[model samples]
Target: MTTAFTYSTTYLLDKSHYIETYEASVPADNSKKVYLIAILLALVGLAVLMLTEINAFVAWFIIALGGLEVFSIRFKKPWWLARQLISKAANTELTLTIDEHGISSKSIHVKSTLAWTDISKIEVTENGWLLYHNDSKNYLSSRALSDEAKAFLTTKTQLINALAI
Candidate 1:
């Protein structure tokens, strides 16, 4: 069997795609530290409120702080992504190419190529796939690709899986 696989497609990098790509780059942590901390903060605030009797300023402040922490955890990533992309790259036409060597992405705004070695993970999402790598991520949308090309990715995934074993 031939080992060479080359696929190329040009697609729009809109707000939703951008957000999804970057967000997936964050490793899914199963650790409960953050949740525990938030809960502790809330419980402490509740205790203070009960002991202080009838809505003390300090108790309310603690509660609000806990709430703010939870809010930050939920919104921080998308917010940061928007800031990074809002100025110029929020919407653009992106042409992506994948071969035996690496992945190359070109756009009206930017041009760059990420080597295959740079790709740490290939996550198949509902819409397409997320290419997670060192310090950067790339999103591949199925809108602009053919079934053959998508199948080629499946082959690559199998190769990766085999290597993992």
Candidate 2:
């Protein structure tokens, strides 16, 4: 089974808009968690060191590590960090094409197009439907699509499935 949908950012964005895709969802909440955890860990470590009266060198090491962790979480480049973390955590492939004209996609071995023959499976998820690729193990998602686009896509998928069967 194969299905296809055309993706274009032009409909959703302005001239300055850029399309960005990650192999995984951006951990929008991770930064806050990082900050909280770092603060707590650093404070706890400092308190323990002070109570235990650990050697200066050991205390410095602990403090330094904690500070480093905090610094990294606070100042690290989010785009680069997102790429690295997402790349490592998710093996899925994602491609996002953005230009003045519109947006396009070619993910999971499926070429970017509006044609229905390019899709394999469409399974609904909490956010949206997961569109599978017939030629590869990778998957693409419809989470970013608007209601109108999703409806259009659903219709296209049904048409494709009908033809395929």
lDDT of each residue in 24-139, candidate 2, tens digit only:
32334454666776676677678767888767667667667778887776655554554545443244354554232323565554455323345565544444444556554222
What is the number of backbone collisions in each predicted candidate, taken in the order shown? 0, 4
lDDT of each: 0.74, 0.51
Name model 1 segments beyond 4 Å from true. 1-5, 19-35, 45-61, 73-87, 135-138
Model 1 scores what on Cα lDDT? 0.74
Error of 1 at 43 (Å): 3.7
All candidates: CA RMSD in angstroms?
4.9, 10.0
lDDT of 1 by residue, 1-165 (tens): 876778888877677776666655555555767667677788898999897676678887888888988877777776777686776766788788878787788987889987766677777876777776776667776667788878877777666656646
Predicted structure 2, TM vs. truth: 0.38
- Pairs of colliding residues, candidate 2: 2-119, 3-119, 8-103, 9-103
